[model samples]
Target: MDLVDIDDLSVTDLGAVLDRAAELKAGSGPEAGTSAGQPLDGQTLAMIFEKPSTRTRVSFETGMTQLGGHAIFLGPDDIHLGHGEPIRDTARAVSRYADFIMARVFDHTDVEGLAEYATVPVVNGLTDDAHPCQTLADLLTVREKFGFDSHVAWVGDGNNVCQSFVLGAAMVGLDVTVATPEGYGIDDAVYERAAELGDPPERTTDPEAAVADADVVYTDVWVSMGQEDEREEKLRAFEGFQVTTELLGDRPLMHCLPAHRGEEVTDEALESDNAIVWDQAENRMHAQNGLLVWLAERS
Candidate 1:
């Protein structure tokens, strides 16, 4: 089994993962702290990360450890994919030693490659096209702040995070409105799938209109990893897209941080009482622990 994108999960399955995450967050287990669960006892997780990270690395490693398992971090320098090794070989090699695989990579195909051959489960840590884990945590955070049905407005680039957010929101029945720059657009297939699920995201170019009545207003860096060369151009295109309080209209704020602070969102909005990013950040561990345990059980 693999979780390459939010679409990999059915509505019920997504609910199960979130429910378990809620339980993990509540510390309902016998032990204390984030590392309380024993669900992955004696298991090993191979974490192959091509992209750099702060939250993804910490949350997964800490979550796996807390779940009674150990995680081995393999960065670009540590992996052969950077040295011309086929991703298939890496997948086969790691699957032999590790009980499961979690990869955060630059290419979506690389994640698909691992899932194609790995005998055990493969979890997507992040990819150029999708980010299932982060969306899971985002949904969990929103579920806590408001109910699952609360309206969410995605107020920036229609990047990978936006794509995955659409799918995750549809699964949990949240109405989403996406307002992005002219050239940027969410994947049509993602939107169509979400539409099939009954809450197709409304697409627009007006950021103000998008978040006008939203319960949660979200944004991401205008330029993500692998898009560094286009920084100046993206910055110009995203000039008026910043998530300011006036545009957000009293709604709670969300950013999957390491935010560009002054660019995509105002500092005041990020630090304001309505900002729930810290809680959103903390839920990454709980959601990931639930995901690891859920996948490990079926595998």
Candidate 2:
């Protein structure tokens, strides 16, 4: 099975993964701390990146090593997919050489095509449409800071990260309120998917209202990679949407980084004691480590 989206795993499976992630972080589980009995010993993961990254690449590569496995990084220049080779061909070739494949690509269909053709399990590290891996790590971090019952307020563009978190939070029964500019709201399909799981996220145009009673407040860059041309327009649209210290109001802040500090959030809010952003970043490895182990067992 491939984890290309948040709903690919059931609530029970997600719970188990988060529990295992905690155990991995605490260094108490059988697969913890570069131990000899590592579950992924001798395994290999092929990482294909169509876009630049810091956390996704490093976390997955390091997570493989900690699990006693190896990871091979393939950048856009190193891959044939951009040279007109079919995704199916590349997927088949890579599956034969590696135990698993993780792809961070611009097009969502690239990973979908990989999963469709690869014999091994394919993981979507990130895409334009969804970012399930990041959501998984975010969920783990949120669970640690404030249990599942806590309310989360998202204040920024309803991009890939927001859409994925909306689905994952609903699956875990967390109340989520999203505030985006009028034209920057999440896709209708995302709402439909979340509603299928449980309650759809509350939508609004006021960031303050969204975070009013929130236990945690989250935001991301107003303009993501490939959207540089729209930066000025987006900035104008997001005028009052910045997560300043005043906006946070004692609620813990979370940002899937590479934050445009002055744009989506203020330095005071990001560097304050209430910012769990670093913990959220560190949890990426632990959460993905647990996920790799789970996927290996099933595969």
Candidate 3:
């Protein structure tokens, strides 16, 4: 099965996946260790990257190694796709060698295409439209901080992270309020899907209003990769959208890192006791470990 979006799985499936993640987080050894080796002892993973990454690369590569599997990193420049190879051909070829395929790319369609043609399970590392794995880690962190059924308030660009969060919240039945700049709201399709998952979310343009009484206030870089040209304009447009202490107003805040200290979030806010930025970052490892194990068991 491919994990392209949260909607692809049922609530029961999500619960099982998360429960397994929690189990692994609580002190389970490498899944393969139980049998005297890695859970994926003979498994091979082909990791395709069309974008630069630090977290995705390190986490997946190390996760695979620890799980008794090997991961081969395929950069855009090194792949047949870069040399005019069709995506279908690339997917079929990689599937022949790899037990699973993980891709970090610019277009969501590319990930979907790979899943379509590849016989192995396909994982979405990231894309311009969604970052499902990151959202998985974020939800696990929220579960740690506030327990199950916690509400999250997102204040900033309704970008890829926000889009994934909406779907993640819906899958877990957690309430979410997203505050984005006018004309920068989540894609209509995402909004529609989230609404279908459960009660319609509370959407607004006022960041402060969204965070009031919120358990977790989340924000991300105003300008994402490929958006460098809009840095100045986005800064001006997102001025009041910053997750400052004032906006947080005693609410705990979370930021996905490589953060711009003074832009999407303030240094003061990030350093506050209520901030769980570091813990969230650290949880990425544990959360992804759980994911790998879960996938291995199912595979």
Candidate 4:
């Protein structure tokens, strides 16, 4: 099965992955790629990247290596999809060589196409529509800190990351409140899906109101990778939404990093004692390790 979105796995499966990640973090897992730990011992992963990345690339590669699997990085220049090779053709070819395929691309449909054609399981490392991997790590981090009962307030663009968080949080039984500019609300399809999972996030344009009763406050960059042209506009729209020390009070902060400090979040808030961003970042590897192990077992 491919992990192209948050709902691809049932609630039980998601819980299993999170539980395994917690166990791995506590040092209960077997040795890397040895004995019982090496579930993907002879497997290979082919990663296709149409956009640049740091955490996504490093985390996946390191996670695969630690799992006793090899990962091949194919950057934009290395891939021929832009040079006229069809996505289906690339998917078919890669499936022959790799045990799994992971693609970080601009278009969500591109990843969908890869999954449609590839025989091996396909994972969406990132896309314009969703980021299940990051959501998985965020869930793990939240579970470690506040469990599933805490209320999470999201203050920023209702972008792909936010959409994924909304859906995942709903499935895991967390209350979510999203505060974004009027014109920058969460996607309709994603919100509807989130409602299906559980309670949909309470929406608002007032960031402060959203965080009033929040146990954890989260934010992301005002402008994403492909939205460079909209930077100035986005900045203007998200002006009053920054997660400042005053805004957070004693509530912990969460941010998917490569943060545009002073924009969506303040340095004071990020460096504060209540911030759990680092733990969230580190959990990327652990959560993904659980996902890989689970996928291996199922396959």
Candidate 5:
């Protein structure tokens, strides 16, 4: 099965993933570490990307390597899909050689098309619509910090990261409040799905109000990968939405890295005593390793 969204997995499955992540985090001994040497000795993963990345590429590639598997990095120039080859055809061909597929692309439809044709499990690294893996890591970090009942307050663009945060938090019974500019709210479809998963999230235009009682205040870059042209406009729109020291109050701060300092967050917030930004970054590897183990066991 493909992991396109958190909602695609049940609450029970989400819990299982997190529980295993915690166990793995606590250290499972030499055998578990050695799983990387023979975990997927004969397996291979095809990682396709149309956009540039730092964490996603490194985390997945390293995770697969440590798991005793091999990963083929397929850049845009190397892939025939960009040269007019059909996504279905590419997916079929790659599936024949790889045990699983992980794609970070500009279009969400491309990931969907690949999944439609591939026989192996497909993981969505990132797209214009969602960043499920990041959300998974964020969830794991929150579990570490404030335990399972921790709440998350998002203070920035209601972009893909925010959408996934809401869905993932709801599935795990965490309260999530999204505060964005009036015109920059999350997609209604994503909100509705979060509600269907369990509890509907609280929405607000005031970032401070959203983070007032939050255990974790999360923020992402004001503009995403494909929205570079709107950087100035987003900066203006998200002016008051930044996670500053005053805004954080007693809440711990979380920023997904490649952070645009002074834009979505201030230097003070990034350097604050309550900041877990680096831990969040490192947890990407641990969380993904657990996810690989979970998926492998289930498969």
Candidate 6:
């Protein structure tokens, strides 16, 4: 079993995951990983990352600790895969000891390759093609701030985060509108898939149009990890898409964090009451806690 994307979980499963997260956050569930109630007691989680991360690393490690499990962080230098070992071979070998594998890699195919070989559950911490975990937290936070039937807007690059948001919106029957530049918009294939989720999404070049009447305004860095060489070009392309406080106009806002400060969004917008970034960021840990418990129980 693997969580490569939100689509991996049906609406029922996604709802269950969120419900469990609420229980965990409310302290309504039994102590996880403890002898009396720990569902993952003595379980070990293997976390592999080729890219640098602050939240992803901390959240997963802390979630495992809180649940009475151990999380071993594996950096590029810590594993043979860093030294040219075949991904499948490494995946198979690691599965022998760890109960689950969570990988944050530059390439989506690498995560997929790992999932194909690992005997245990695999989680997509992140990838170039999708960031499902982050979107899960985003959805959860939006639900917390405002009930369903609210409109959300994405006002920057239609990257991995945007893709995941679209899919999540479709799954939960939430409405989302995205505004991005021509070359930097959502991939056609991804948009096509989203169209099937429920209501077709609106992807446009006008930032203000999307921001207007939106309950939640979200944005991400124009330049993502592994795209450093294209930073100058990206900045130029995304000049009109910055999510300013004025654009939000009292609407709550979200960013996955590690924000560019002035690129994708202005500092005013990020610090204003409209911003729920800290809560959104914190929910990553709680949501993943629920997801981990859910996956562990299945195994």
Leading candidate by lDDT: 2
Error of 4 at 271 (Å): 1.4
lDDT of each: 0.88, 0.91, 0.82, 0.89, 0.83, 0.87
lDDT of 4 by residue, 245-278 (tens): 9999999999989898889888889999988988
Q: Which candidate do you rate higher for lDDT, 1 or 6?
A: 1
Instruction: Kindly list the per-residue Cα lDDT of model 3 for residues 178-276, writing each as its tens digit.
Output: 999998889999999988887556899988778875788999999999999999989888878988888887778888777999888889998899898
Task: Give the runs in model 4 whose Cα sits over 4 Å from its true position.
Answer: 28-36
Clashes of each: 1, 0, 3, 0, 2, 3
lDDT of 1 by residue, 79-134 (tens): 96635878788888888999989999988988999999888899999999999999
Model 3 lDDT-worst window of ten: 28-37
Q: Is candidate 5 or candidate 6 better by TM-score?
A: 6
Which sections of candidate 6 miss by over 4 Å? 28-37, 80-83
Provide the TM-score for each candidate, comma-separated: 0.96, 0.96, 0.93, 0.95, 0.94, 0.95
- Cα displacement (Å) at residue 188, model 2: 0.7
Error of 4 at 216 (Å): 0.3
Residue 84 Cα positional deviation in candidate 4, in Å, after optimal superposition: 2.1
The positional error of residue 58 in candidate 2, measured at the CA in angstroms, is 0.8
RMSD of 6: 2.6
Q: After superposition, how far is residue 184 of candidate 5 from its true place, in Å?
A: 0.6
lDDT of 1: 0.88
